[model samples]
Target: MANRRASERRPSDRRASGLSSRRPSIDPWRLVPMDKTVHIGGSDDFNVLFIGAGNIMFGSDEGPWNHSFRFEHKLGRRLKVVALIDPAIERATAVLQKKCDSFVVSAYQDTRVFKTLEDFVKNMAPKDRPRAVIVGSPPMFRGSLAPGRDIEMQILKFFPGVAMFIEKPIATGPKSEIQDAFTIAKTIQDSKTICSVGYMLRYLKATQMMKHIIDENNLTVMATIARYACAYESIAKPDWWDKSKSAGPIVEQGTHFCDLSRYFGGEVDMSTVNAHSLEWDENAGALSKMAVDESKIAPENRIPRVTSATWKYDSGAVGSFTHVVSLQGTNYSCELEVYADGYMLKLVDPYVQPTLYIRKPGDDNEQMVRFPDDDPFFSEVSNLIDIIEDIEEDPEAAQILSSYEDAVRTYELTWAIREASERSREAAKLKAAAAA
Candidate 1:
């Protein structure tokens, strides 16, 4: 009886009740069953081309400093090394073979060798083109100042929009080369290319935590102090001893701290930078004590034993960095400290197990946080890959802290420091002459 009564009701009564006669549409794809045997959530193949195969790419006899071993370890089976470009192909081959035999097995076995980048670009098919390139070549071979020697511009010409990982001390020839390297910054920015300079310390978890604390407290950084003491006695490379080739210790090895100082403080005022260096002297007891032969490169061409540099940041904060090449064995001492009102943050032993010591307002003692298993090398490479794939989830972690443009600024600051030290040395010589 109720059904008959409802059927008797007018269509206007159903419309007033807000009832729809049409059924909701269902997606046809959702009806299909997913195969259980197929693997899910795996990434695709990532091909990488390497421009150099030296200690920076494969690592040194001592450890994995500026090494690409972490790249393979992080990507696992997904990484494919397409080719290596180097004049000394045999060195690269041998190093990769040793790495595969001793370390984890990688796809290096199928990597082809090319004497030059031009040869690789001309010969390789479009399907086999690398999605990313790692330029680990020497400083002399990079930058635009030298017309025929710029590896970066050549790569961009051949493979536009390819992700790049360029190691630091971008170019090491003369002042002109550094200036030329700076010009590429505009090109990189214009192309919207994804580039990361090899300042891996910025990717450290401890560094991110420090940044987090700074932001949380809205702290105003007053100053940054950094020191890098290297184990110079263990350095056996002939080129490294030559100031012309390696651009001195301050530009080559000490750049890490200089870059970090800028990271903590903002952009540096180039005109305000000043520095002093301790030159190697045979008569001086401190300079003559090193195991390295000082006479090989002549006194003028040899790198300084120590360099202390200071600069003013754009934010009016002052920063200082001192690099000393006076240590024995493989233990290198490195640390950076940031200061603000009622706050102090110090990061020690950045290369190895990095630890952060923090002191806050009204705290009785400083708190210590240690990161033992943090591999920033792996993190930097992983972040680059994530960026290339457009799969980066965390906005903070996805940032490329050191871009090519930013590194050029650091390079400029390092050169300025070296020049300031040179001026100081020259002034000292004139003062001695006047006394005589």
Candidate 2:
């Protein structure tokens, strides 16, 4: 970690736990003070900050999609993101040095890595503060700690009305804690901050064309089917398999489809949802075949290997989602198909190499659509920047596709599936007991 000037060091920097130690001074649900209706604007050079430095920032650089590198590419010299706040400063430094070069390295040459948000707030002057902040932290941060304060809430309490781009599955926790996090979302809304959730799929050109076709044709959607199957070997984090830490595959990985269901079918009714799952047993022969070490899997993180769920939207459109994690190697497949009157739309692999197929009435052929400009991760950050700059120019002109409030609906829908699956399991157990 680069050393900060003496004047930039504060008493708060001494905290042992680092970023997690910054408790919110304001009530989580209370709106923080906002001096202006337009918060971020009128700056030629943008000082962006990132809260968590992990795979999404570094590994993404050489992969199919990388948010940080794309962001720097779009802004060019106008961007000045010298420092990022993460408890693991050493990891951040290594990633930045390894993945980024030339201008990217020069920007952070004098970087001052703060161990905690508290230290940054106390040490940095107002002028050095960020005009925008990207939160790449895990969904687990949404869970409450010993003092009952969520890490997400702490960020909201500290940086009110600032342009924020938060990564998706906005939160992951117990039902009660999720409800609490949503309540704080209300505060974010009340503050009228320029906010965008990292539902980058929504920004894809193929997806945009799909939306345009649906709206322009005024097709009456009937039912939708979403399927996701992928080899989990590439995941950098073992916790990805754990339901408790990462919300399992449905809420964590399949969430893009859940959101797509709503995008095409309209809002879903939780009461209308039905779900089933096949639990994974480590002692089973399947584990031995896969060469998985049972000892490496955490007890609390145990989750079903396959889940199938169905639900009806408030619009009376039916939808089904199926997820399977039993595949091997790096082979993967993801598809969301919508059936509507006289037309069908299919979207594939929103994560990378996305493509869309449309079938029109009386056409034996399905037209394939691809976007050469479809770097969604690029558009995702650029869109936020445009929104922030626009709001600064005129608040009413800025409109973002996925806001915190909107993403919460998708989160709720995914949780409903998980909850319904559990209920089905309990019901099955009860029925077997009665028979015995």
Candidate 3:
């Protein structure tokens, strides 16, 4: 079915469909009402520092939905990019010259590029320090177990209390590295630093509406079913196909859904998690039929074609997620369904056009709410700025939905799912060996 836009809907049609024409107001963390009386950062310049110049920070040829570029467009002349720290300094320079227009280039004329964070820190004066820092480095370069090696630790230590916006999959490495990365959460908490993980979906209008409905009805969530089917065939990165580098699809890609599931179901019981996957093989019903060549990589290192996982939330609610890496082109099939006693809430196509479907008690038909041209990335960054601006006036002025500590839990859950699926694969192999 084609998604209908809110602008296209007539006032009478919205009333008949039980849809409100009014936009949902942004609530502070914990559903607290926002105080409009407090003055946010006005026309003053908002200085920001970037840790990486990759696609997440600056838009690549693949897409133009990057955070740095979006923030520049949003803030205009008031946004000051103090500097960018990256090993490949040329990449940042290229992005400024090629991807951006004259206005952006002129605004960022003073933006410097450094080969490393240490270099940038040494040269930059305290007066030029940014109030906000965005870390968009590769997963492997983020949260490190070693002191001075982690981006988060360095920022907190040097620029005390600076607001941070770290990209998703916070860290990717072996089991030891992931566990070590978890330790950074406490440092962020103790320092009282305002940090937000890049789980932009939580900022979506449809997601907020879903939460509003669930809260209004005082519904007990029974289950959350989510599916993420990506366009793996079009993936060009070699590291992405390798489990060792990318932490497999579940940890790397499907984490968005896993985080969302936790968002609705509350804390998850790690012990209750179990998972299974469809391995790639020449046999029928195997992932080999997809036509992607994975013969070069060993079976153990290659990512699963499909992963199915289930877990129980601390609320006693069950949840299940399925991730499939078998779609063509960029049309990813993603959706989440939440079931309560007598209501069902389904959010679909979050990446492009987000549409929420609601079916309440005694209603055989589902009501659809379309959020067109909704950019969660922009919302997340804009909200972060608001928090940074108003934090001095009221410590509780703004709330970060996905804080560093909260994101660690989601990271642990994804790792648990990956571990469970590997165990299942090993068990199947042992059974076949015994039969042979």
- Return the TM-score for each candidate structure: 0.87, 0.83, 0.87
Candidate that scores best on TM-score:
3
TM-score of 3: 0.87
TM-score of 1: 0.87
Residue-level lDDT of model 2, residues 152-192, one tens digit each, is 56666777777888888887776666666567678778888
Runs off by more than 4 Å, candidate 3? 1-41, 61-64, 99-101, 147-149, 282-293, 391-398
- Looking at candidate 1, the ten consecutive residues that score lowest on lDDT are 21-30
Stretches of candidate 2 exceeding 4 Å from the true structure: 1-43, 60-65, 98-101, 143-149, 282-292, 295-301, 391-398
* lDDT of candidate 3 at residue 296, scale 0 to 100: 68
Ranked by TM-score from best down, the candidates are 3, 1, 2
Report the C-alpha lDDT of model 1 over 301-364, residue by residue, as the tens digit: 9888889988887667889999988888788999999987688999999898889999998995
Give the clashing pairs for model 1: none
Candidate 3 residue-wise lDDT, 1-436, digit = tens: 1477967865444333222211223442332212212223467777889888888887766653598766775566788888888888677788766634565764477888898777888999876689999999898777776744588888887799989999988887676676667689988888888898999888887888887886676666779999999876567787888898888989998989999998888888999999998876525225433334676677778888888999997767899999987787767899999997789999999988889999999998999988775677776776787777764465543457788877877888899999999899899999999999
Which structure is stronger by TM-score: 1 or 3?
Answer: 3
Q: Which predicted model would earn the best lDDT? A: 3
Give the Å shift of residue 45 in candidate 1: 2.2
